[model samples]
Structures are given as structure tokens and as C-alpha cells.
Target: MKILLIEDEKDLAKSIQDYLKTNDFVCEWVTDFSLALEKIALYDYDCILLDLMLPRGNGFDILSHLKKLNKSDGVIIISAKQNLETRLEGFNLGADDYLVKPFHLSELLVRIQALIRRKKFDGNNIITFNEIQIDLLSKVVKVHGISIDVTKKEIDLLLFLIGNNKKVLSKEAIAEHLSGDMADMIDNHDFVYAHIKNIKKKLKNAESKSYIKTVYGLGYKWEDE
Candidate 1:
């Protein structure tokens, strides 16, 4: 999954980023409100980690902008400041969860996982589509009760496709989701084709139904046959 972490503390942000990476999550971080504003305005994230205190501006301003845009990105407020009023304000401004500073990285991971599960799979860690079953917590994919050897990147690609269901996903979108903002610098998204091909092969080997469809001149979509 991809997360946008809007935090100002350099050490803490790096620690969070490094921790998230070890768990197979892509976390893009911004230290100031201006960049946070731009990221929320332009891109979509599985979840957002917002620090209430920032340089030049506060998290509330960024939260307000997100609310105005009506983005579905799940948000968790992380701040040293704690109170009922602040908590209520964060919720009123579209925050999904809150975590105080001096928190455990493991606890933060659990929170992010729960939030993403709620947002994507309606609070279920297991994603089932026909014979395919993906256990998010264990990072396992099974077909007909048989385990498949799916890589982490392949798992990410599979989730992205299944989460969108029937929506057409452009190669650019796939690349950006898998590679973050760095995708914008690349002239080709052909690597996305490779990921798709691998998933297709694995699913076929496991005797799963074909769900991913190429849209010819457009992109790809997960459609029921």
C-alpha cells in the first residue's frame, strides 16, 4: 500500500519511513504544509499520516484542503498535542485515526493496516474474489486453498487491480501506485506490463479465474468474465 506521511520532524519522519518500508509499504513523506497540500491535491494515497504541527502552517490547514477536495484517502493525525477538542477537530476535518507522539512503530503499523483494511476491504484483512483469496496480514494469496508464490510487488499489483474492480487503470496509474512519484520521471511504464504478466501466469497456474483484462489502446481492468 502507498501512504503520504506529512510530518516535520526529520528524524521521526525518516524512522517512520524506514519502518514502513520493512513492512512492504510505500510511504512518501513531506515535511511542510505546502508540499503536503500539493500531494493531497494531485495524488491519491491509501492513507495519510498528518502531523498536527508543521513548519509555517499546521495540519488543520492541510486537513481542510483534503476535506474540500473530498479525497477518500484515509488520514491519521500524529501529534504531540492531545485533547478532546483537537481530536474532535481532526475527525471533523476528515481524519480517520489519531496517534500521539512517543508511539511505537509497531503500533503505528497496526493502525495504518487497520485503516487501510477498513477503507479497502471494509475492515476485513482477507480479500476474496472467487477462488482467489488474499490474506493482507500474512501477505499470502491462495487459490482454491492452494498457496501461490507471489512476490510482494506482485501482491501490490494484484491488490491494486482487484481494489479498483472494473475501473480501467492506465499504465501510468499502475506505475505511480507501485513506484510513487518517481514514476512521473520515467518515460515508459512498460514495467507494469511485466507485473501484470507475472500475476496472470501465477493465477493461471493455480487454476484461478481470469479477471484482469487488457483494454487494448487504453489500459487494463479487472472484469468478470
Candidate 2:
């Protein structure tokens, strides 16, 4: 999954990025509020880790902007502002969850996963569609009860496709989702095609239903047969 962390503390941001990357997440860190707003305006994230206190702006304003844009990206306020009023303001501004600082990384990871699940999969950690099953926490994909030997990127692509089932996802969107805001920096999006091909082959080999559909001139979609 991809996350935009809008935290100002360099050490905490680096530590969070390292830990999240180890768990198969593409984390993009922004030190100031302006950069955070730039990212929010440009790309979509599965979840955003926002800090209320920033050098350039307040995180609450960011949340307000997201609401104004009608963006459905999940947000979690990770702030040192621990007062009830602050927490209430966050949720009222469309924050999904709140995490106070001086907390455990593991807990933060779990919260991110949970928020993603609630936003995308209707609060289910284990996603089940036909014979395919994906455990978000364990990062496992199984077809007909058999685990598939797929790379982490492939798994991420699978989740992205399934989560947006019945919706056509453009190549650009997929690329950005997998690579975060650096999608445009990549030389090309051939890796997106490669991952799609590999996932199709693996699922076919495991006897899973063909659900990924190609839109002739558009992109791809997860359509039911």
C-alpha cells in the first residue's frame, strides 16, 4: 500500500518510512505542509499520516481541503496535539483515525492497515472474492486455499485491482499507487504491465476466476464474469 506521511520531525519521519517500507509499503515523506498539499493535490494515497503542527500550515486545513476536493483518501492524524478538542476537530474534519505521538511503530502500522481496510474493503482485513483470498495483515494471497508465489508488488497490484473492483483503473493511477508520488519520475510504466501479466498468470495457474478486464482504449478493470 502507499502512504503520504506529512510529519515535520526528520528522525520520526525517517524511522516511520523505514519501518513501513520493511512491511511492503511505499511511503512518501513530506517535511512541510506545502509539500504535503502539493502531493495531496497531485496524487491519491491509500492513507495519509498527517501531523497537525507543521512549519508551513496546519494539518486541519489540509483535511478541510481534502473534504472540499471530495477526495476519499483515508486520513489518520498522527499528532502531538492530544487534547480531546483537537481529536474531535480532526474527526469532524474527516480524519478516520487519530494516533498520538510517543507511540509504538507496530501500533501505527496496525492502525494504517485497519484504516485502509475500512476505507477500501468495508472493514475486512481478509478480502474474499470468489476463490481468491487476501490477508492484508499477513500479506498473503491464496487461490482455492493454495498460496501463490507472487512478489510483493504483484500482491499490491492485486489488492489495488480487487479493491477497485468493477472500476476501470488507468495505467497512470496504478503506477502512482504502486510507486507513490514518484510515479512520474520513473522512466516508463512498463513495470505496471509486467505486474499485471504476472498476476494474471499466477491466478490462472491457481484456478482463480478471470476477473481483470482490459478496457480497449482505456486501462483495466476488475469486472465480474
In candidate 1, the residue pairs with backbone N, CA or C atoms under 3 Å apart (3 or more residues apart, or in different chains) clash, namely: none
Going through the candidates in the order shown, the clash numbers are 0, 0
Runs in model 2 with CA error above 4 Å?
A: none
Candidate 2 C-alpha lDDT tens digits along 126-208: 99998999988788999999999988898899999999989999999999999987889998888888888889999999988
TM-score for each model: 0.98, 0.97
| Model 2, total clashes | 0
Taking all chains together, the TM-score of candidate 1 against the true structure is 0.98
Error of 1 at 34 (Å): 0.6
**lDDT, residue 174, candidate 1:** 91
RMSD of 1: 0.9
